[model samples]
Target: MKTTRKILLSAGSVLVLLLTFYLVWANTGLGSETKQSLKIDATASYGDSSNKGNVVGIQAFVEPVDYASEANFRRKIRFYMEEAKKKNWLIPNKSIVVFPEYFGTWLVALQEKERIYSTPEIEEGMQTMVLRNAGRFLATFLKCPQDVQDKLKYSVFAMKAEVIARVYQDTFASLAKEYKVTIVGGSVLLPDPVVENGLLKTRGGLLYNTSVVFETDGTINPQLIKKAFPTADELGFICPVKPEAIPVFNTGAGKMGVLICADAWFSEAYQTLKSKSADFVITPSYSNGYGYWQQPWSGYSGSKTPEKAKADVGKISLGEAWVKYAMATRAKEEAGIKKGINVFLQGKLWNLGADGSTIVLSDSAHATPFVGKSALINLWL
Candidate 1:
């Protein structure tokens, strides 16, 4: 009888622990830490335009947040941006706002409510879901015909596709509308990104790291350009696919082109934009480690350095290397871009230590150029 009691007690304890974990997993909130986001730093050089046509790089600091719904992400952004106007931050007619790459990419995790936010570690949270959905994950990514795993994966992402895309679009579109500025919505991982009739939609197969542009009216502009080159870590999760043809956006602010994350590392991209006579470039990037910005240049990101630039990554700091090769060497000199902005997200998401501070490279002399670590950088068009 005593032995029987011991067995039951052990079973009960296990059940209790599982139940406790479940409760904690499914409902982790941002907690009591409600404070206005720190400005961190701000710099402006060679852009003292008071009248109009300003491009702003928002180096936002995101928290370990799990959204109950997609709108919550927008709410958070709105709250953080309240500090902008009071500081006399420049927002004028025909302005452009650039966010960081993959800033909206994590919204897909919200599909699994459990531990989406409550998991103490981002890797743990993503892994937990990945374990449960292993078969489907493989199936969708693999895209094998008549394969149960592939079909299941496709169905899952397809069902959640609209939500993931919507959360991304709404978050940035809303901001653009509120500020009355054309906004680059950053990059999101979607199975298929199709912008039809000014609404974003997705189809399931393999994911692509895609960035979209939104006009001031909170509607998406129909320019679907995929990342031409992806970082090593992004390989398994997404595939690199370029658009059928390069398309430059003719926004009122300026003739703008976007290079999402590592896409900016290629000269071909710059050449394509230059062919279209792109007036300004917005490069949205996310460096995985916090100190990578200060690390020595480890050769080209993916492409060969231009022979004309004669760049030696080994001899230069990573930042200088970026100014040289990443944006296609002497961006102002080669691309004919007198003004540009590079924005990076500054937050700890999952395992990614967001680094690579924002920079606004300009050929303007009288206007001070952004050189150091500044969370926000603005340029006049």
Candidate 2:
């Protein structure tokens, strides 16, 4: 009887251990699956702009002499990437797009002059020379063949265009691998280089100021649209906001749109996003100076104190402008909580909610152009 009781106890102990192991294994798998399902995050980073600095154009001019070093640029990119990683906000299997202000026309012109123009022309062309040299350097870094480099010297614009496209492809591909997110918009610039129109011909034929969208699977979508604009004329470099541009916003698995600095200033762009059912609009602008525009108000004569006059003088106020506009545009349209629009100006990140409210997500002002770093934004529903 004693022997039998001991044997029964051992059997029960073995059964308990097996049950525990099964529960542990099942829960582990379940936990991972839950994490995967709950994955929802997005981010937008403004590429290369200045804050409280002198007025500069949006075109991709070579960095000012003060911040022209390659190391500086790399640091800026690295800092932004690190911030993205820390926020637990990096979306995997999604998209990340960079909007570098003034990238389109300048890059194209620089390359064209470098490869095809005469030596004297290059010397005299300030912007073109700077862009050409930068393109050559980037091409070399990417390990383009010497023969390709030689050819690029004459057809710099074409070569640079191809290089820019490839660079974005590779960068997105790398990010996709690391963070598991698909980078959507390729580097945007003025005037799409792939198209030719007579009226819009500014050196490189009729081109629409355009944005190129790149996919993570190594395929570029709407290749023709790279140079196609809904309302742009052939020779006109400007792309007037049109109702058709709105359709590009309807990206099914949560839409993403990149609006250059000027594009965001217009109400139509926001309306376009709404019409197309875009969930978020990433505005990357390079404003050289204060972009405040105000309307004059008529006033009746009234006495004011000297102190009040001093305080009011030289002060420009856009009272409730952003809020009113946002409410009218985004909220009234039933867009996501006013935070759908992510505005990245220079290195500052501002989260604009659907209600026309704003929250500063990151500020890199204290850090010099390249030395200081900022944090990334984590958007929660």
In model 2, the worst 10-residue window by lDDT is: 31-40
- Candidate 1: give the clashing pairs: 25-115, 45-368, 45-369, 46-367, 46-368, 139-149, 139-150
> Candidate 1, residues 1-381: lDDT per residue as tens digits?
999999999999999998778666644542223343344565543456656477777776764453435545666666445555554553644777777887777675654644545555766765666655555566554563342333433344444566788778867777778777687877777776788777788766566778888888778888876887876566545567663255689887778988887776666677788888888888888777667776777765544556644457567666666665655344566677777877877775656667776666665322123333335566776
Misplaced by over 4 Å in model 2 are 1-78, 94-100, 103-160, 184-187, 190-204, 216-218, 223-237, 249-253, 265-267, 290-338, 347-375
C-alpha RMSD values across all candidates: 5.9, 24.9
Candidate 2 global CA lDDT score: 0.35
Please report how far candidate 2 places residue 173 from its true position, in Å. 4.2
**In angstroms, how far off is 65's CA in candidate 2?**
8.0
Give me the runs in candidate 1 sitting further than 4 Å from their true place. Answer: 1-40, 43-46, 50-52, 66-71, 88-93, 111-120, 131-160, 302-311, 364-374
lDDT of 2 by residue, 1-381 (tens): 999999999999999998777555433321011111111123333322222111111111122221222233323344454555564444444435343443332333322332222223334443444344564545533443333323333233333445444443444345445654434332343324442331111232222345554444434445322321221112223333353453353332356545543344344565665666655554333322222323221111121223423443334232123222322233334443232333222321111101111221122111112111122333332
Highest TM-score model number: 1
Q: Judge candidate 2 at residue 249 and give its lDDT.
A: 35
